[model samples]
Target: MAFSTIKDSITFHPLGDAAIVIQAGADIREEIHERVKQLFTCIEQHPFDGFVEAVQAFTNVTVFYEPYTVHQAAHLQTHNLSPYEWVKGYIEGLLEEKWQGGGQVKRRIVDIPVCYGGALGPDLEEVARINGLTSEEVVRIHTKGTYLVYMIGFAPGFPFLGGLTEKIAAPRRETPRMSIPKGSVGIAGKQTGVYPISTPGGWQLIGQTPLPLFRPNENVPSLLRAGDEVRFVQMSEKEFFSMKEAER
Candidate 1:
């Protein structure tokens, strides 16, 4: 299904009985991300009878709803289409309207403090060695650019970011680590992200953050959300320890 001619060509795929994926595009690009976020906002602001929530990703939004609620909805009874078909039509109609109405939304920028290299970053030297860059050069280049919070997936609060400078890009480690500490920052290819919880991962560890990214006890567990921007602020090991001590 075509949402608009202005870069967003949407395609729908059924995700079981109660959900569907609205794919705006196939590639990883900023415009596509923005469009995805806008669609998310539109759905949140003006949802249908059974609308529950939308999960964001690279170029898609997975919308979840109650099938029973939709099946019994009075206004929707006139439509002969099944719940899935009606929901898809609802999204497509909104997309068409948003395109004609010039839909635009603001995003938030978040600052992340990181202490690059050293023991905190076990593989920092390896990344530099592979890229033919000094550790300091790698740090400078990594922190210089602003990254987009493309989505929150993989683990709980793990943010899939874009806009990592190609110069510092490095492949994931050949062998995965047993247990990566929470708040560890790493880069895999052109993607840079932090470990929100202890998990096995292979991204080249560059540093660790003291800030908590996931809090299960909170109403909204994830520290960051889709459509937010992130800037990494470099700090010294001394400062890291100081911050940790203060948090304790």
Candidate 2:
């Protein structure tokens, strides 16, 4: 089916029976991400009869709704439309209204302290070699850039961060690690992320953060969220150990 485009380069597509994806653009950019977040806020504030929740990503927002609630809505009864159609129209209306009141939400700045190289970052040197850089230069490049949390997926609190400069960009390991330590900072291609929990992964290990990215005990388990700004602060091995010990 041909996709429909709206103002601000937005597009809509139905997802199965109960969800619809609203895309801002074809590429990943900060402006496109801002549009996605704006749409997310619009849907959250002005929900239709069957609205469930809106999930944000790099260039789109996936809105989930309860089909039954939509189908039974008195206003929708006269339209003789399916749930998907009703929801699509509703979102279209929102888009036409310029994503009402979704103006520039304040972004949170999150600082992640890391100890780069040595035991914690086993693949640090490998990454440096791949990029024709020294381990110190790689660390300097990484800590200097500010990253954006484009989305939270793969694992709980695992933030897919953007804004990795080409200077330090490295490919994933040829072989996946059997088990990665929790809070390990790794780079896969143009992206960088921290392992929220111990799991198998292929990203080149570059550092380890002493802070816990995932905390199940908290009401909001994930330490980070989409739209947050991230900055990496370099710490010494001694400081890393001290912080880790304090967490325990």
Please report the TM-score between candidate 2 and the true structure. Answer: 0.92
lDDT of 2 by residue, 23-43 (tens): 788888887787777778778
Residue-wise C-alpha lDDT for candidate 1, range 76-188, written one tens digit per residue: 67767778888888888777775433455577889999998878998889889989999999999988989989999899999988999889899999999999999999999
Candidate 2 wrongly placed segments (more than 4 Å):
1-8, 98-105
lDDT of 1: 0.87
lDDT of 2 at 219: 98
Candidates in order have lDDT scores of 0.87, 0.88
In angstroms, give how far residue 30 of model 2 lies from its true place. 0.7
Give per-model CA RMSD.
Answer: 2.4, 3.3
Clash pairs for candidate 1: none
